[model samples]
Target: MELFAVEIRTPQWQPMILWYTSALNMKAAVRSVEDGYALLAGRGWRLSLLELQEDEPRDRSAISLALEVENLSAVRERIESLLMEPSAPIETSDEGFLQWTTTDPDGNRIKLFQFVAVD
Candidate 1:
């Protein structure tokens, strides 16, 4: 089965929205400030952002999302330009992928990778 969307709850909705839009270079397909939600689309992924309630528990360090990208380096550069530091150095796996991890403003982990065929 194919994946459709991922729901991310955060207290910082505006910055989260801005971050996703800028990093992915895509606009929200759906958004409702009143409802406190937004849906953002990239090449083959959809991110749903939900406003965190005051009573809800937030453990941003525990959230992690893996994304397959076309150009890992470019994505890394874009992220750095946005002033977000990657958590680790980019590395290639024996399985033929270049990867790196980074965190959002609220400390949500984002792992990005690109497949690279090894000769």
Candidate 2:
């Protein structure tokens, strides 16, 4: 079975929405500001964002998402343009993928990668 969606709960509702849309280029498929929820679609996966109360217990650091991209550099530039620093610089994996690791507004890890072209 294929994975469809991942849900993230955060107190930074609008900031998280802006981060996913601008940084990852994900489209806001469903938005319910009144309900404090939003669904972001990227490629074939969907990300669900839900608002959380300040005193709510949330392990934002426990969530991670990896996205396969066609142009790692372009995505990097977009992320940088938004003044968001990556967790680390882009590097190539022994598995033959160029990967960039970064965190969302709420500190969720996001990995962006592209298959390395071998000549």
Candidate 3:
């Protein structure tokens, strides 16, 4: 047997969303989030915007998903590249996982986590 290839495959949730309050406000949420998507797209990140139910008490809070390319730097760059610069700068988790949180046009928190590369 021989090695074929390895690459960041699927996304794994390294850390859960730590916020207690749900950032709501749809119209404004999309408006701001759209800016995020446009910036990511510009960076060659194919963004998949999804409406999904969050976990626990925050379940009621709306969420905007960003499924981008599986490169840590790429993921971080696309997010940081945003003109708005997010509420906070991109950060790496204790586990060396890169993470970033932004708000949509409304106020819904949009979290971006990169996938691990593996074959």
Global local distance difference test of model 3: 0.37
The residue ranges of model 3 lying beyond 4 angstroms of the native Cα positions read: 1-61, 64-68, 79-87, 115-119
Write candidate 1's Cα lDDT for 1-119 as tens digits: 12346668788888999999998796799999998999899987888788887787876665556677888888888788765443478998987989887888877767787889997
Query: Stretches of candidate 2 above 4 Å error?
Result: 59-61, 64-119
Tell me the lDDT of model 3 at 66: 46
Residue pairs in collision within model 2: none
**Over 4 Å off in model 1, which ranges?**
1-60, 84-87
- RMSD of each candidate? 11.2, 11.8, 15.6
**Best-fitting candidate, measured by lDDT?**
2
Model 2 lDDT vs. the true structure?
0.80
- RMSD (Cα, Å) of candidate 1? 11.2
lDDT by residue for model 3 over 1-107, one digit each (tens)?
Answer: 11111111112211111110122211211212322211112122222233222442343225455443356466556556663643566666654445566665565
- Descending-TM-score candidate ranking: 2, 1, 3
lDDT of 2 by residue, 5-117 (tens): 57677899999999999999999999999989898999978998889889988665666666778888998888876555534789987758898877788877677888886
Q: What number of clashing residue pairs does each candidate have, in the order they appear?
A: 0, 0, 11
Q: After superposition, how far is residue 111 of candidate 1 from its true place, in Å?
A: 0.2
